[model samples]
Target: MRVTPQPVRRQVEERLREAIITSRFMPGEHLSDRMLGDVFGVSRGVIREAVRLLEAEGLIKVVPNRGPFVAFLSAAEATQVYEVRAVLEALAGQGFAERASTEEIAELREVFEELAATRPGTDRMVLLNLKRRFYGVMLRGCRNAYVARMLDQLLNRNSQLRATTLSDPKRLPQTIAEIRRIVEAIERRDPGAAWAACREHVHQAAQVALRILNQQARDEAAQGLEVALD
Candidate 1:
């Protein structure tokens, strides 16, 4: 049987969504409908439909008169996202440790090994993809549909924030150590330890991300004040 082709609008949406998540489309950058239509070789209507889909996913925003722009995560939004992610990841870790088969655990370990082997100065995208693969194994082995679904919903936004958090050279070694702890706990089939390790990793990442977001907000505020004084 022949497979059905995906709709043009959906294809465009996925391409744009990946671009946004990978930071090829920076937050707050304007997205021109005509330009996108030309780039994607699609009609303006198709571009509009793709933009609407991304907007619903919180990856794009359409202003009344200014057209569409990539969505930016405010500090408050980032904090809430991380808070939810921490709890969900802990649940996933617990489920994976308690229920995953020996083969599944081995699979997760294999992915973790790849992630650990990534050099400290590896390309950001390469590291991010490895991390995604590691998490994919855990999510699949967790055997909780809701946990997987919730995490999936947060992934794009997580990538958006991660561009900042993962840029700090110091965070690479710390992140690897944290992930190693989680993998070690899972290897022992210790659900409680796995849950704790996963939660702690998210917590530390949230702290670093929040610090950068807060500083950026302060700098923007200062710039606005200077403009007002002028």
Candidate 2:
């Protein structure tokens, strides 16, 4: 009854979390424990444990008698998330602007370079990982454990939306430009400017994501209508 390699459960949890956040496992899709166990090369027990982790993160839900399904974002939930992120990210920017050292600025620049080099149309999951690295520079620069903890959940969800937005060729330039402006404000040690820039960035991105999510819902609804008509 041993789950081979033991640590495979943790690996499976990470993989599933990535898949869910990147939209690879779309909302409302029920995850079959047996199929997932096979996919991860682990036991059903391991898959259950992995799902439990995601459920706790609010990225998945386990319904009684219905198994586990990927979590769907309500419009209200999405708006709240962006609102909270704006305040928290502004605080992070302020903290970073006030005390970010030259070394930290250079580190952030390096991450920005990495982000720029990443070509468009890359796998969403891979782009998310890179985006996390870019965000890591800002979070570390802020140097506040509480802010970091508050942002963890929001950041995970943001990365998913960011990836989807950036996937569109039309949005890529604006995304990069907005991020660059924030970086410039931070480098100048202008906390007010940094906060303003960061807030605008988050707000614009949120609008784009909301549009994308709404469009997806419409597409799904249309498909369901077609099925019904058939």
Best by lDDT: 1
Error of 1 at 96 (Å): 1.4
* Candidate 2 residue lDDT tens string, 104-180: 98888787777677666766566567667767878888888788778877877555677777777677667778878
TM-score of each: 0.92, 0.85
lDDT string, candidate 1, 1-230, tens digits: 99999998889988998899888889999999988988889999999999998898889989999999999899999989999999999999999999999999999888888877876567888777777888888999999999998887787776967755665678888888999999999989999999999999999999998988899999999999999999
- RMSD of each candidate relative to the true structure: 1.7, 4.0
131: Cα error in model 1, Å: 1.3
Best by TM-score: 1
Q: What's the distance in Å from true for residue 87, model 1?
A: 1.1
Q: List the candidate 2 regions with Cα displacement exceeding 4 Å.
A: 1-9, 117-126, 227-230
Displacement of the residue 93 alpha carbon in candidate 2, Å: 1.6
TM-score of 2: 0.85
lDDT of 2: 0.81
Residue 50 of candidate 2: its Cα lDDT? 88
